[model samples]
Target: MELNQVYFWTNTIKDWKRLLQPDKYKHVILQSWQELVSRGVVCIYGFVIMPNHLHIVWEMLEPNGKEIPHASFNKFTSHTILADLKQHHPQVLPFFSVDDSDRLHRVWQRDPLAILMDGQEKVEQKIEYMHRNPLHERWNLVDSPENYRWSSAPFYETGLDEWGILTHYKDRF
Candidate 1:
């Protein structure tokens, strides 16, 4: 399929607010995100990391000469996240069923919402909406989106980050 826009979303295995999960696992999710960008899978556009869920807007890249049915950044991260969660959070084991194929019902929800931004207007609008998500009606974590370190807002506003981060302020990483 031709590549353009992708919104990949996933939630915690049990909606357990592993939100307070130590910074240790922060890399688990972020590393997987960086890997995709590093491997030419997607040109990340925007993202937001809520306590139990995440939403990402990426411009899926179809590099020349690559052969694959599809390059789903979502699929790769889903597996990595499940693996990471299982390793770090085995307490939730009983909540899921493991199958012979190695797939487990570990995702809080099968899929949250992976809508494609089919046009420039929608893409721009989604980008803006995602940036302002932290400010939505009752979602008051901060007075401004840039105050949230887990989202791309700060990356754009202050250019401060710890590791591999591709944004308008990639130098922060």
Candidate 2:
């Protein structure tokens, strides 16, 4: 959440709804990252999008406007996902309805985990964990880390940025 510091960020869908199981929803997160990176507000070092949650190794370079980049990211992605669900999947929208006065539907759980990565060892540790997440027994999304399409593993393995949203962690740490 702090500027100029790398963080291992984890945000999950409300009540673990598996909202991101659809590729379109995952693209919503990806596009948000791409926009933030293009604007130089954040630099993504690593990431993985699971069925219900996502983990990112990223650094906030500057504020998006009056708010921190991560705040903007959460707000934007939430709104975007909400809009899509309202128009295309109204039946599924009720699952996210909340009793809060400020909002009706909440896509992301509040107060996501963001751990400061103060050293290369910590950063590397987080990235490797994220990369291996898809191969975990719970999800078994892919047989290998690099085979997972929604992660930075392939980028690190082949030096390719398919989403054009990653910065090699070494470039910063």
Candidate 3:
């Protein structure tokens, strides 16, 4: 989680709910990354958005104001998702309700995993793992890694970053 260091990060939804099954919610994640990258807060190398969780290969370039980039990401996405649910998906709100004093609904589980990737090999390994995740038997989301739309696999395979949110890992490591 150190600034300017690459990390393999994973964050999951509360209770492993498939709240991200919808395309709209996934876009919420993409938008957050876009904002972070555009502002130079982070440099994303790879990522995948699964049904209930997400994995990212990124480096924190700098703090976003008073908050670290990832923390700001989680907070913003959580707030946006909560607002969307309250407005249009009220029925789904109960599933995320909690007794916490700070918030009524929790979108993301606490203590996300962030492992430092100290070398090119580790970064490549994590990127490969994330790219192939959609093809795993448990999910079977796509026939091939690059076929998954919500991942950086396609960018790696074709050198195309449709969303302008990714940086080539070689540029850093």
The alpha-carbon deviation from the true structure for residue 91 of candidate 3, after best TM-score superposition, in angstroms, is 0.9
lDDT of 2: 0.95
TM-score of each: 0.66, 0.98, 0.98
The C-alpha stretches of model 3 lying farther than 4 A from their native spots are: none
Q: Pairing residues by index, what is the TM-score of model 1?
A: 0.66
Ranking by lDDT: 3, 2, 1
User: After superposition on all CA atoms, what RMSD does each candidate show versus the true structure?
Assistant: 5.1, 0.6, 0.7
The pairs that clash in candidate 3 are none
For model 3, state the Cα shift of residue 25 in Å.
0.8
User: What does candidate 1's lDDT look like per residue over 82-169, in tens digits?
Assistant: 6765798777555555453756555445545667665556656666676786677756767888876667777667666555555541
- On lDDT, who's better, 1 or 2? 2
Which 10-residue window in model 1 sums to the lowest lDDT? 64-73
Best by lDDT: 3
C-alpha displacement of 120 in model 1, angstroms? Answer: 4.2
